[model samples]
Target: MGWKWGFFTAAMVALSVATWAAGYPWLSERITPPHESTSLAIEAVGAARSAGAGTWAPALLREAESNLRLSLAERRRQEVRVILLRNYADARALLSLTQSQADEATRTARLQRGLAEVEASSSLSSASLAVASAERMSRAIPLDADGRRHLARARSALIEARYHRDNGDPRRAEELSEEALQQAQDAVTRANTLAARYVDEEQIRTWRRWIVETVAASKKTGGAAIVVNKDKHLVTLYLAGRAVRSYRADMGRNKLNDKSRAGDLATPEGRYKIISKKGPNSSRYHRALQLDYPNAADLRRFESARRSGELKNNARPGGLIEIHGEGGRGIDWTDGCVALSNKDMDDLYPRIQLGTPVTIVGGDGSGGVFSRAIQDAVEENRIK
Candidate 1:
């Protein structure tokens, strides 16, 4: 009976020892310190904040930070720590993904803003250049009603575009600037076309031939001839077919066109003779040389226009065209007359006599002087 009882006690002690050994690892794991993954996750959260994740991934970062704090507070249990470590690893991976997406989004936005700025600047420059070109051409040529209207529209568009640009609307500004540039370009084209119509190539060639013939005839006769070039703003005195002198001159305010009636602010183009002269005492200018305007050809054209109803029945072809002094004002201010400086007049008045032939031509007698004049005006008016 004693031996049987000892065997049972030994068997019970062995079973108890085996059961204790099996549970020892489980208890040790529960009480152990948290894994390294928890620390790594905390560091990753800090890094994300430093990289601006707070602004770009606020919700994701907030949740991850909250979970990490909860896990750290309960870190005494080994099982709990292990679970927290796993959760932290997942949070870190999510944080990394969030930061990458945020970075990509920020880069894309910056690139778009930069490209918009470049386009806006380029469009503004193009619009400015076009407006400048249109202004210059308008100055050199006589813009008809349609041409004037187009230029006004272009200027209006440019002003509006500038307004948008200054108000911090880059997208609207870019679109408006492009529109302004196109309008300005169209204005220039219309103005140039209008100018071309007044002095076609054939007309220019005819004027050139006439100038040559008139100069040759004057030389043979030992008489002088006067040539007025409106585009060059010059009055040239030709003696015996030789250009003896050239003087800077100004014409009527609207000298781009030929005078067709009284009060027309334009200098007429024609052949004429100096009919008389007036000194400072008798003329408003320092001196004046009257020309025989409305000659036979002028009268015939006037009559024809009247018959065609192109001219008002009462509109008379005005006659007091003259070359006079009081110029050098840098602008055309005459009313159907050519003007020179007082000094230039003093030099020319003594040499020219009554009956001297005078010829007035438009442009350079080549139909190309207006183009050069437009270019010069454009350069002069560009923003300094």
Candidate 2:
């Protein structure tokens, strides 16, 4: 279609042979020189037509049609040549369009192939993430045994998700992926809690269990005392007004609003005892400390909400919130939990006993400015 010239010579030869076969033998024998010239011209015209150059064929058919007209001996040949040339032009145009369509089809095929590859690659990347998450959890044991079992089950589900995808079951694959994402989110969240953390690398932790046993063995006068200063953001040990150790910490994502009801933005204020401690996190956060967030006050508040339709009737009770260490130190950031450095949590863990008193200043009744904000918000809600 694109100006190929090879069809000309073949066209000429074919026409000459047809003329000889049609009884036009020699120029000198039966016809006048002019008549012979005209017959020879007819032969040339046939060849030109066969060559498929027609003026009407866009650029492609234009020349062949013009050439065929020149070979015509009679004026009527103009009409015949025009008709033949138009047909030739139409045929060539069709051929050109067919080629274009073929090329486009090839391109579309390649595009589909590329998208299929992306889908495959995304799947592989997702699998690698699952393996890494599992491996990360395996390196550390959760502070609580029950937490450990849940984490194990989550990892197992992730494996099944991957398996179903590889085996070509998309329905199962989608469901498993959804569950894995949820579990991973929850596991990382819970890991931040101090109620369930582990000893940091090469850090010496408190031998609280040993201390408590020794104290219990000796039958000491007072129970263990835990204190937190919301104003100073300091957690203190009260062995009689003596500061044992202080660690830098981050507050919460929300301001002084103590988390009163479930999903409250405020961190709860007031006196509360540590019920459990969770550990060295397997999460991106360096370490975590779990606090008993939904204490008796929280439950009562939540219960009222449930009855009044202020809370979701089917919501699962979230009881454990925490103080923990994140990827880096400095800056308060959490849903409603305290935060510390990974190294700090490791140092503080052993010193904290199971029933230590935790007094958050901005959190408890004697809280810093933060606690007042929580109190104000709570009061405003009550007024409304």
Top of the candidates by TM-score: 1
Error of 1 at 54 (Å): 19
Per-candidate clashes come to: 2, 41
How much does each candidate deviate from the true structure in C-alpha RMSD? 8.2, 19.3
Q: TM-scores, in order shown? A: 0.72, 0.34
Model 2: ten consecutive residues of lowest lDDT: 195-204
lDDT tens digits by residue: candidate 2, 92-203: 3333343333333334434444454455446445544543453344232132454455456566767786787677544465566656655543443343242121222121
- Computed on alpha carbons, the lDDT of every model, listed in order, comes to 0.74, 0.48
State the TM-score for model 2.
0.34
lDDT value, candidate 1, whole model: 0.74
The digit string of per-residue lDDT tens for model 1 on 1-384 reads 999999999999999998879975765454445455456656766665654545545655566566666555544333445542422334344444444444444444445555766788788888887777778777776577887887787788778877887875557778887777776666666665655534566877766776787798789988889998887788999988899999999899876777778788889888889999999997899999999987888888889988999999999999889999999676789998999999999999988989999998776544334657455534544212
lDDT of 2 at 54: 27
